[model samples]
Target chain A: MAATASLQTAPVPEGAPITVCEVGPRDGFQIEAAFIPTAKKIEIINALFASGIRAMQVTSFVSPRAVPQLADAEAVLAGIDRPEGALITALIPNLKGAERAAGCGVDAVHTVVSASETHNLKNVNRSIDASLKDFEAVFTLLDNSGIAVEGGIATAFGCPFEGIVPPEQVARIAKRYQDLGATSVGLGDTTGMATPATVRAAVRAIRAEAPGLGIGLHFHNTRGVGLACVMTGLAEGVTHYDASVGGLGGCPFAAGATGNICTEDLIYLLNESGYDTGVDLDRLVGAARLTQATLGRELPGQVLKSGPRLRRYDPGLTATAAG
Target chain B: MAATASLQTAPVPEGAPITVCEVGPRDGFQIEAAFIPTAKKIEIINALFASGIRAMQVTSFVSPRAVPQLADAEAVLAGIDRPEGALITALIPNLKGAERAAGCGVDAVHTVVSASETHNLKNVNRSIDASLKDFEAVFTLLDNSGIAVEGGIATAFGCPFEGIVPPEQVARIAKRYQDLGATSVGLGDTTGMATPATVRAAVRAIRAEAPGLGIGLHFHNTRGVGLACVMTGLAEGVTHYDASVGGLGGCPFAAGATGNICTEDLIYLLNESGYDTGVDLDRLVGAARLTQATLGRELPGQVLKSGPRLRRYDPGLTATAAG
Candidate 1:
């Protein structure tokens, strides 16, 4: 009943390995109004990988008519360099998208369904059962192609249209995905209604029902608790988190709000908190700068604007304020 | 050797009261570029008090020519309405500032000294020991006046001019504050160089050195992990935290950055995380809107734009993208 119910969690060991999955190419670019050039998208994706991002959702395999921004997904997948042992993934909505991704060089595909029934209908014009049934076809096509499947439960924390989603619902869906031979399940906080309470509830419920399924958390910074939620995830023994370069996306409901948590900031937090994310902080910031230069505006990343924690300044500079 | 040394902290109980100290009037307004009218500052401070802010750093008693924006500290303290059992405080720089606060209706005075010698010299043109020596007179006057003293240690986590401040340095100054009969001490993240490793080390050292002194944390969101650092503070059992309304302050060194952690967002996180701060979320958001309207532009607060967590939207609203 309380958010602090799961406060007594295991300590993440010093140098504990964590997987920071980059979802900017798919989740961030999909919502961007202007179409990012195909070559620029590949350049940013390659830069992120070169910075030691082993797992990334590079692009979405969707119809060009629907999301014009991600129309060149196939070309991007073909043109990008693959670092050894890197796992490139993409978002697939249906069997057709799955087939397209199979022809590309993607190692995995993330399939999504909304946990809220109302939101499920609003998002995909279908019921939860219908969406799950459709995923079966996607699973069959991908399984035959020997591609990994990551079940995504959107609105897993709270729904914007209908608030206070039940944890049992998320668990029940995760169990279904587990039965469908999925490798992992991602809890997506779309629209950023997640708090420590909902995150703990969903995670605990899924652990009980789908004990074999791996858990990943994808949070947006819409209400500004994204990284705080990440802290709780670490305490709860969740090691995989999704982040976007430059905090690129935005919520339609909240103006001037950032969508995904920033990549460089996450790395800085993890490295300082005794976790080994295996990502270079400076290289990640360089990629963020590249994205910012391409977009021609300041992103919502704080560490991007300010250098790392130990960065020194000239003693001659004027001190601004008393603490 | 690790930042996770204090990860095995006890849980903060449900309905456990947390002290949310509002520091925007002093910390945020003093650095604002324009001179906010004295009446307008009072209106915002009174509105914040009406929203159940029990403690506040109302203004700074500095020279008018130095920080003209907060020149009306006396007027602002007199004009604001005080709730029952409210503790109104002010930043006192010297014996003169303490005498001014003693005459005004201030419950307490916060005297500051930087832990880093270079920063202390740059900020106040004095060495750390000399600054501490000067505070002795201010403490004497305030002690006689029955005003509480909260000693502040600037650059407690790290310093910009001198990177990687030693936790022992912070503990030494905090012990000095204890000797001076201070009730509580604040660890200031001056220049936003704080991290979980540094926060843990400093809090642990202070607990060992001066167990009697109550601890308060003042963190800037300049590095995007301000709330994440607050998570570390909670794990360390540090309860009182200082935040600014509408994220009003800015880092002079880092462009496009915010200074203090936003007060409304902190309240929301605490409330959801099973702590009772005795502040209404909607009312706090309302106060932020008032501040934003008065400033004639948007503030950096996300909850101010997004509303509360359980806020519902129209189901008819279109979903922008698949999760």
Candidate 2:
């Protein structure tokens, strides 16, 4: 080869260990039309926990009338056998939800604040300032409850109702959450409007503002750039990511919103890219299959349908001899 | 509003202009079981050309018995309205295919060689060495035809029959293609087995061996890392990419292979990331819609369903006042 001498240069830097926070039970189930049986939900959650996933958002403590699909959040959270050192989180919309989640002994409670004011009003029935007040109330309610709080800024990239969300707006909300005692903050592409540039800019802006806060990303595969956004986030030193099994999850309020990044697929990417996630691929696929069985339909995960890339095929002796 | 002080730093660099080579006509149609009418193929290609796409892989001149979907390669080449300054290319398997393409006046003729020997044998019924010999014969046939040649190395990242192809093998094939008068070499993830790390390593290795060659990428969204792999390629200074409109391509020979990176989605990413691709988003979506209509089903592209991110949403004065 004429120029093989220059091939000695390493192309990719070894990335740090990444934490994949499985949000299938909460985010994936919340949007399903058919109600999943409580037992089936517990089964899937248990299977996912047994798959060596260290963290997960188990369910959301929202109003039963608002999200009937996850109305059995309390029962589902209480039924699963909590693994040692696992961070089991729950989505909470208000101080009441936070209190209920803390009572359920969840490791963390996640709250949402939209970067777009129009989206914030539509999503939480409050302005950004009102949401900040609610977050303060939630913090007060969770005081000394030993439960960590994660502030999630939705539509951090762009909004369906408001075209381009300013990164400065996201940074302001993130800073307020940090000052209000949030342990971490997550940026969400609620409408799947994020590109690599916007994702990187959002991360940098938020990181520059909340220098000491842990940052995470929740991406939708709506535009098919979910993993690409994750790659840019990784390059910018983001380690916490939220993914769904079987590529499940979508927003009913957000038009054209689709599934979140598939957990198995994200794991495959991170593992192949030299980032340790400590999750078992086979077990994750098993969980995805169980999900499909429960849902009575095929899911959108690639690794669930196509086995892992490292799977070996026995070409037999004749093929080897030919090679 | 606490942390909006330092929002002036640009997070993403202004990347160089990128070339998006639309391959829906050839790669997308190749695996489709239903035969698209030849007129419809020409219609979509013409629409794509009018959408400001500067290059496209129009069709493949392969054995009709092998791929009946694209049997009308010559008719399609003659029918499409070739735009000024557009580089319309065709996929050619061997000397005969190359001669047919040259006679049809294609701007370029593309050939394939697999990095995995098993994949090579399965794809073309020839060994790697035999494929090289065929390339040589094709080069001789097109020597004075004024048609450039593109050598596409299939299974360049990993193979279903042979797991984890070595970068050295890909570099060797690329080197030989460069020596044999290939103006460019495209690395194909035929099975969608490439991750960012492997994609970067392959690009670096291949670039090392063939410094003067124009390198392009053909990615499959099989494992959901298609765009991520493209992001890595962009970081490594690769300017050419192959995307299928509506993400409508899959490799029948490569088990579990799915659609290619969607052209509309790729343009959205590149344009949003500050790279000029000279593609019209709305017209591209129209072409994708035409493809979906032709197939009598919805395709996998998100931009086709969600519209572009820059699409303005009229919140009305009432909504703004409420916010």
Predictions' DockQ, in order: 0.77, 0.34
Which lDDT tens digits does candidate 1 get at residues A1-323? 00011122365566878888889889988988888899999999989998888789999988899889999998999899999877788998888888899889688888989999999998888999999999998887766566888888999999988898999999999999988878688889998988888888888898888885788889998888999999888878788889999888877788888889988889989988878888889998999999998888888988999988888889888886888
lDDT of 2 at B73: 93
Instruction: Pick the lDDT winner.
Output: 1
Candidate 2 structure quality by residue, lDDT tens digits, A1-323: 00000111112256556788999998888878899999999999999989888889899998999889989989998899899978889888888998889889998888988899888887767899998987898888877777888888888888878789999899999899989988678888876788888987887787788777777888888877889898788777777889999988864433454578899999989888887788988999999999999999878788887787877666542221110
Residues B1-323, model 1: lDDT tens digits:
00001222354455667788999989988887888999999999988999998789999998888889988989998899999978788998999999898889788888989999999999899999999999999877776676888888999988888898999989999899889888678889988888888888998888888876788889999989999988888888777889999887877788787789999989999999998788998998889999998889889998988888888899978874767
Residue B282, candidate 2: Cα error in Å is: 0.9
Flag clash pairs in model 2.
Answer: none
lDDT of each: 0.85, 0.80
Weakest 10 consecutive residues of candidate 1 chain B by summed lDDT: B1-10
Candidate 2: lDDT of A323? 9
